[model samples]
Target: MRAQKQEWYASWFNTPYYHILYGDRDYEEAGAFMNNLTTALSLQADSHIMDLACGRGRHSLFLNKLGFKVTGVDLSENSIDFARKQLEQDASVDSSRITFDVHNMTLPYHDKFDAVFNLFTSFGYFDEEQDNLNTIKSIKKNLKDGAYAVIDFMNVPHVLRHLVISNSKTIQGITFNMNRRFENGFIYKDIEFTDGGNKYHFTERVSALMLSDFQKYFDQAGLELIDIYGDYQLYEYDKFNSSRLIMILRKQ
Candidate 1:
């Protein structure tokens, strides 16, 4: 039997501690960005949208609230379960307009959505260069002709410029020690924490790909780069100064 390759995200993201560690994430900021983006694009009501890597359906819920039909796909079964439960329990959400599924982003889905979103620096997790490229190709195959796609990623140069080497924070009685480093074209983070008299550790790695790298992938995927933004406000891109590289691409 062939050995199954271990992916960092597969283990780290499945644990409940992952949610606890990142529980303080700025949902308000994320919601603001989504609002700004949908408004900017003038998304029509009832348009079909795919939230690629949609963890627990936070953004997908919001998108559905805005009247778009949303399909939220994540690699983690736990996250997909949580999203499904949320959709079932939430009274305000149009449950029929939202769905959740477990999926791998590197595989192609044909002609299904009017828009696709891979937000919050969700790309570049694969160790193989071709796997990373395959994700873009898969995304291209998922969209209909002339449909828009949004990729919200960190600006590599800006992230390195402002990189904090280490930090410690306590949440819900667990103190998490986090260390960050850049090496061999990848950004790496080591996280350690203790709870209930047990210690746990995990590592995260993502390719430190720049804007030009994404441009090349888009070209190879037969997608056209329509616009680039520096931040959620959608200001023009400034590689050195921007907090994010938000690319708006179109399936050509």
Candidate 2:
């Protein structure tokens, strides 16, 4: 059954992962990651890249630093606004080399790029399975004739084996306890946030489609998975050993 996209990452992406993934040390990891990816794709600095679901333009910023013409798109208005602010503050690169736009990824894109990126398990936020399919097609639409697209996702078996079903957090002095559950391919979580003043709760769901299933979507979109990585390094994917499944797809 197809699920509805009720719990999108409009605000949640600005949480810890956002700050952690874009910080200086995080940026170093990102540089290594981009270097690995670009080498695997055999891309040059002149390549045009699209950072799909590019929250706050971190990847795009790095791509721009590498001299790639980058276009970043996301559905979060706040994130986009902040991305623009970051863009404005950046004096190291030519301002026109990097651009950020606001749009839902479940539709066709007007322009094609030499490379397309969907990092950090951003593919499954759309509740309906077809939305994911459309996102692939949309990426295909925006990919140049002989370019590549990459997606990074959590490895299901590993998560199931090492899953912490519940945990508590204190963010900015506000504490929260979270409970997680697995159903079908979705990881459901209950986030109960409590401050000294108030309490709030919310639910989030992320889908889990295996590598083979993703290949099906890639085939539907006229793409082929050329490589797979375990986490940030090139290693074999294991049901329990690998933390992530990073797949690189090329247009056929």
Candidate 3:
């Protein structure tokens, strides 16, 4: 049988240009968020964490540094390879405490974890709404009984309120032109650029999901929503003002 066609994310996320475009991400901020999150979750010192859609393993590595055993998975093989290479180059980290693999978030991971995290707006990429619910169910299947799961996503209202319709950024001598629009309950971002004598275009489509929408998905997936936060600081969520919609859930 012929192989199934890959999704847009599988192709785009695996590209070197994707890494270049996002290379300036704030790692310190990410680390601080992880610190606050692990503390808030009350994870044990030896807790096992599943970092779903953990591109390049930034959060996974930091979680490992915080004394947790971390399993980071992403659909991008290039990202997983990069994460593994970084792991091999870091001498102070105990390799046994961390692992990186390429896996689909919609499928149940084999090993159960004490806590599962889908961070940095990593959710809501599927064209079909059922896939999003499947991802939630998969997370439930990957968690031990009574364990916690977290999903950090963009606040749709806030994003739409502050949306810049068109913009451009120059990175690594490449100028990327970007345009964004919201239609049919999805946020679409079109990116165009030229590099190495070639022109490229990519589009990112994320469902504009709100708290109520997520509540329905969580309920359908047999998970209970325990808490809601607005940002990396873990403040109470405000529908219009917050930058992030962070949900903390528990398997029912």
Best by TM-score: 3
Better of 2 and 3 by TM-score: 3
- Model 2 is weakest, by summed lDDT over 10 consecutive residues, at 16-25
List of clashing residue pairs for candidate 2:
none
> lDDT by residue for model 3 over 67-117, one digit each (tens)?
999999999999999999999898867799999998999999999999999
In model 1, the runs with Cα more than 4 Å from the true position are 1-3
Residue ranges of candidate 2 with Cα displaced over 4 Å: 1-7, 10-25
Q: Could you estimate the TM-score for every candidate?
A: 0.96, 0.88, 0.97
Cα displacement (Å) at residue 8, model 1: 0.6
- Model with the higher lDDT, candidate 2 or 3: 3
lDDT of 1 by residue, 137-226 (tens): 999889988889999999999999999999999999999999999999999999998899999999999999998999999888889998
Query: What TM-score should be assigned to candidate 2?
Result: 0.88
RMSD of 2: 3.2
Q: What is the C-alpha lDDT of each candidate?
A: 0.90, 0.79, 0.94
Candidate achieving higher TM-score, 1 or 3: 3
What tens-digit string does per-residue lDDT give for candidate 2 at 138-225? 9888888878988988887788788799997665666667899999878887787755566666667888688778889988888888
**Candidate 1 clash pair list:** none
> Pick by lDDT: which candidate is best?
3
